[model samples]
Target: MTAQRSGAGANDGSTHRPRVAVFRPDDDRLRDAVALLDSLGVKPVADSMLAVEPTGALPRDDAAFVVFTSKTGAELVAEEWTAGEETVCAIGEPTAAALREHGISVDVVPETFSSTGLVDALGDSVDGSRVEIARSDHGSDVLPEGLWDAGAYVHETVLYRLVRPDDAGESVRLAAEGDLDAALFTSSLTVEHFLAIADERGQREAAIEGLRAAVVGTIGEPTRETATDHGIDVDVVPHTADFEALTEAVLDRLEGE
Candidate 1:
């Protein structure tokens, strides 16, 4: 069920900067998000949501093509695996940049930066070729399924598991209390984990209500669908699927209100 987008204009005639919750993993990503939000004049509530747990597994070496879907996956793979003759592909610029940071050359980066886009970018070239997808356990099934449909022999390696941090419910408390003015959900898993924590804290309904009243932003369609499925009214989704874009778009919406 989709609801009409609503603003957190709860502070209509006040001087309070919107308190936007960010659920980036605790690391440079979280810090960067905080800096971006602060620069945009929003009070960022830093909530570390996803934590990377490396599985210590490497991609199969005999594949004809290797695909990476995230910066974390790229970094993990680069720690132990070196790109050889297999063509390397990234889902987006950030993953490609991470690969390059480890001296791995990226061969393909789709214009649209999604599983469907990668399938279209690879086109008929993967026919009968062995392609290996290395990513976290929470990866969407779209990429592997699309590759198999494209006549590629696909192998998936779980390079890491994205676990919710032990102490991650601060934002949930804030939302349940109607203190959050906006929230940036970067992935579907983030949306799920956020609600899981809310449920744990016995504040799921209250948190959902708070988010619906606030400006909810997602990174892409998948994330938006996840939030909407959970009854959250998503107000902003930038054309670009990155934290900076998502944050800026949510900030713009908040400012407009």
Candidate 2:
């Protein structure tokens, strides 16, 4: 999600700059969110719950079409200097934008921005195609399974592994602090990791209950459910799953408060 313009506001003549806890694994997207928050005069507690570490080697020119479940996976292709030109399918708009920055035209982006939506979107094209489903270490299974059912020659690439930061102590502490006005969760894993880190630091309950009124912007419905399961009350879920929308939603929510 690239940065988009929005207006700034403060409640009741208070100089309280609303702070947000942001957790997205990709660098570009995190930057975009940070920039948006900065533009709105909101202080962002920017820290990724998960860090992307490259793991498996990328197969050279092996795919006619590839599915990227995360922006980090799509960026790895550019970082490793892998040859472009393969038809790419990104799980969401941000991943597509990242690929487009490298001049790779995205063939498809799921209307629903989920694995099932991508599977349905690729229906006939996947058949007889050399497809690669590339993602982080704890990669998902539904996309590859659906492609195989479509009769595609599929290769799974674990380009990187997403691990919780070793020094999440500060992040967890800040998240639970009363001054934190909002929290942004880009994925279900982010919610899980945020809570896990808080729990690890013995602040899970306060972090969850304390932020009860904070505008929790979950990127999608599934992530909303995960946030709900963690007892995080979600205040907004954008129609499109991108940081551009998330930033807008957070701003709108803050304005309405």
| Best by the TM-score measure | 1
Provide the lDDT at 170 for model 2.
Answer: 51
lDDT of 1 by residue, 1-257 (tens): 11112323333534466788999989889999888776665678999889999999999999999999999889887867888899999999999999999899999999998888899999999999999999999988889999999999999999999999999988899899998899999999999999999888889999999998899999988899999999999999999888888877887787677
lDDT (tens digit, per residue) of candidate 2 on 1-257:
11222323433333567777788664766787777787777777887787888875674477888788887777777655444677778898878888788877788898988887898988888789899888877755667888899889999878888888776545567657765778888878888888888877789987887678577898877789888987889999998777778878877788777
lDDT of 2 at 235: 90
TM-score of 2: 0.81
RMSD of each: 4.6, 4.2
Q: Which ten residues in a row have the lowest lDDT in candidate 1?
A: 1-10
In model 2, where do residues sit more than 4 Å from their true spots?
A: 1-14, 59-64, 79-87, 100-105, 127-130, 148-154, 169-171
Quote the positional error of residue 48 for candidate 2 in Å. 2.2
